[model samples]
Target: MRATLIPHVPETHVYPEAISVEFEREGGLLWLRFIIDDNPDFIAWPGDAPVGRADELWKHTCFEAFVTTDDGYREFNLSPSGQWASYRFDGYREGMRPADEVCVVEGLDGGRDYVALEGRIELPVEPRRLGLSAVIETVDGARTYWALAHPSDKPDFHHPDSFVLDLP
Candidate 1:
């Protein structure tokens, strides 16, 4: 499945022209892709820095996925710097724990005008819904939030209504 992520607020867009996330289920793994369309000189992406599983990647430029099943949900943060993290929430912002059970592989593709992140994770159950989002930080230290759907007036990815992508 593929969907375009729109900025939470139109007036707040500083750098990115477009952002999107796509997912493909293969065997027991889910391959995810995030694309950011922007001028290289304009966006402040963390170039080819080494990244590991860390917290608060969202403080900068990062790609995110909120996967929801029947029991709970998992939040995956994938950064261009090669760092990634996953958190399991029993409910909305409840029982937060490091989802270290899933191994993730992330990398960059393409160049200046457009860059893409390819990530793969072991998904044991089919997701019921997904909230795809991104936190884009510009060279001037401005941040913009993008998501598949912005149900609230503010940028709230955790809002239950943000899970607009219903799966089959």
Candidate 2:
């Protein structure tokens, strides 16, 4: 699959090998997991929003996590109370717009906190253009956009250098 650029941080630095993904199905749910190695010092504060340190970690790292079934798709959001908030996407159709969601996952002790972002994407019948974008902050206060371009059918998980973030 080929990845292209969408608007994002211009100076974003990504570790190609630091990305790992897995897909599995359990009972009536389809799961996709994405783990990326991110610096703990890099925090996300949503546009002057009031967020504590722990809350910031949850907001920045946790993108989205959910389950899908043949009947439709069910999405879950992580609550500050540490509970699962659920939602359903009954409007999902074969040729409709791609479904998008974001959530945060708490890290286990001794593990570096990270973000888990996912898209319950639907590919168009014909080749449809799509962009995968992410924003990360550096310890030095620089924000960069990491994005890739690929067809909806094939998600781009390769490093930015492979095609998405090609310098040229």
Candidate 3:
């Protein structure tokens, strides 16, 4: 499945024309491909680093996925800096703890006008709904939140209504 993300507010610059996330389920693994289109000069990306787990990657340019399970939900933060974070929530923003499960990330790479992230998130269960989003920070220290759906007036990815992607 592939979906485009919209910025919370009207875009003032032409840094990025669009952002999207793709998911493919195969061999008990759910693969994620996030693409940021028309990132002029690639100024928003923080550059590459050693691939590993880290915290608060969302503070900068990053990609995120929220998968709802039987009991709770999972949040995966994939950063362009080669860091990733996975957390499990018992409820809507409740009991957030590091999932500690490692995901296979190929590292964030980009071209002249686009950036992409590819990774394999372990499928804990068959997700029925999903919230795919991103936090983009430009070289000028400006930030914009993007998501598949913005149900609230503000950028609230945890809102139940934000999980607009229904799976079969």
Q: Which stretches of candidate 1 lie over 4 Å from their true place?
A: 47-50, 124-126
User: How much does candidate 2 score in TM-score?
Assistant: 0.36
TM-score of 3: 0.89
Candidate 2's residue-wise lDDT over 98-150, tens digit each?
24433333322223555443332222122112223344444455444334433
Per-residue lDDT tens digits of candidate 1, residues 1-168?
Answer: 888999977884446888878888777667889888876566677767555688888998888888887878888888888888888888988999998546475687878688888887655375788788989888888888999889889898888888887653
CA-only RMSD, every prediction: 2.0, 10.5, 1.9
Candidate 3 lDDT over 28-126, as tens digits, reads: 567889888885564577666677888878888888888888878888888867778889888999999988456777776787887788987765565
Assess candidate 1 and give its TM-score to the true structure.
Answer: 0.89
Better of 2 and 3 by TM-score: 3
- Candidate 1 displacement at residue 91 in angstroms: 1.0
TM-score of each: 0.89, 0.36, 0.89
Could you arrange the candidates by lDDT from highest to lowest? 3, 1, 2
Error of 1 at 147 (Å): 0.3
The C-alpha local distance difference test score for the whole of candidate 1 amounts to 0.80
